[model samples]
Every structure is written in structure tokens, then in C-alpha cells.
Target: MRGSPPLPREFRLVPGRTFVDASVLVRLFDDDEPVRQAAARALVGDLNGPALVVSGPVLAEFAETVMVRLARPLAPVAVRRALTELSELTVVSADASLVLAAADTAEEEELGLRDALTLEAAVLGGCDRLATEAMRHGTVLRGIHVEDPAFGGNE
Candidate 1:
């Protein structure tokens, strides 16, 4: 992914770059939660690269959830197509720096490693917000605000 200079810290109050978590992505194809499905669709309807950020771990989680955890699992080809369609969004790769940062966040936030990785990915990707259903609304981790976009929270 191309690197963009981090925005000034004060820009946090504004809606800028957003990191999407797997929880929201999985809702896109989940027929069981129609309200959330609609909200998820609306949140991502117009988002594109640069403004939208996602990480490798998040994508993998999404793929796994859709394949094995969903009530109606998608075929491999369908999942492949979905992933391909997401190519427009910026994707962050997990690395040594990311792992170390996540480890620190895990201890500091009392979050699991996977959740910490998602938070750290948002910071490393220069995101001002993180949209997910996995964390409490309004929780801030390392300068990124985590919210559940499908509910009553920031997108």
C-alpha cells in the first residue's frame, strides 16, 4: 500500500481515513442481520482506497468467518470475487513493527492480540477512525477511535 503522511493529531475530530474491521465486512453477506447488513452496505457503499483502509489480518478473519462461521457459507469462488472487489481499498500488511505495536496495545488496552492488531493496523495506516462491531463505541486506541458503524456510532 502507498504511504500517506499521518494527519495532524487534531484531525482526529474530523472524519478522515477509516480502518474497517472484519466484523463489519462479514455482515455484508450475512442475511441473518438485515438491519446491520443495510448499515454495513451504506457505510461501504461509496468508500474507496485511501479513504478506506483494511488489513491482511482483517481480511483473513473475514474470509474465515464467511467460509466456516456463517449460517450460509459462501462458495470459494464467491469469496474470491468478494475479496477481488475489495481491491480498491488500501490494504495493510502485518509485519514485525505491527506485531510489536499490537503487543504493546494488547497490554495497554487489555485487548486480545487479534483486536490489538486491528487497532494497531489502523494507527499504522494513518486512520483517524476504526469502524467495527468488535469493540465498544467511542473507544480510542493509540489515537484511533473504534466504533460500531452498524449501530449508533461513528462510521
Candidate 2:
């Protein structure tokens, strides 16, 4: 699952906003993985850059994982703060076009629906980079550079 589909031709990392994946957000509060937590902090701490882009589904997934699926669920107050903080990012809502694009991505890239959805969301958000641990550390998907900020590959 870490392997990425081939990059599109004429790929370049543009100086645009980053699209964050739920995997990265979940690590922000993951105490078990101190290394990843620090990495997530370092990546998200900088607000000076262009606003990070996220999607409604990504935020919901992050919230649900932290609140219900984690080994130690965060308190209600912590979840609220996390949601509030994430809300500051540019959130893209999924629509029919996005879903259709995701379907094509899934078929073409041989990716699962959710992963394809995330990638398509990033593309729709007009992002140049995707900060995530779910996919390959340094790979281009639909012109967006994927980076695993926690694992130390592409920045």
C-alpha cells in the first residue's frame, strides 16, 4: 500500500498549499509514537506557510479515529480542540465531481476508494504537496508530491 502509482509527466513541486492526510493528523496526538508525534508537531507547528488544505472527510476520519478507535481515546475537550485547530485549515467539501474523479483514480491507480478519494481531494484542493504516512514517502500522484513528514523522506 505504500507503493505509489506512476507520477504524471512533467512533475514539479509547486509553491502552493499542502493537503494534509488524516494519518498525519492522527499522529499529532499519538503518544505511543513519540518520534512521529514530534515529526507531526514540526510539520503542523509552522503556520507561516500557506494555509494547509484538508477535506471534510479527512477531518471526520481523524476525529473518529482519535475519539473512538485509538487505544486511548482523547477526552472530549481534547477532541474539540483538535477539531477546532484542524478547522483552521482550508477544508474542501466532497461533491459529485470529486467522487467521480476519485473513482477514476481508484481504477487507474489500483488504489482503494478511500485512498483515491484522499488523493483526488488533494488534487481538487489545488495542493502541490500531500503530507501523509499512508502512501509512499516521496511520490507524485496527480501532480501532487506525497510526503511522509514523520518517516523522513521528502520534506
Best by lDDT: 1
The 10 consecutive residues of candidate 1 with the worst lDDT sum are 1-10
Best by TM-score: 1
TM-score of each: 0.87, 0.85
Off by over 4 Å in 2: 1-14, 47-49, 153-155
- Tens digits of per-residue lDDT for model 2, 1-155: 32334334422333657888899999988888899988888888764434588899999999999999888889989999989978877787888777777888888888888889999888767778888888888788877898988766465
* Shift of residue 50 alpha carbon in model 2, Å: 3.7
Q: Which stretches of candidate 1 lie over 4 Å from their true place?
A: 1-15
Clashes of each: 0, 0
| Candidate 2 local lDDT, residue 51 | 53
Per-residue error for 19 in candidate 2, Å, reads 0.6
Q: What is the TM-score (0 to 1) of candidate 1?
A: 0.87
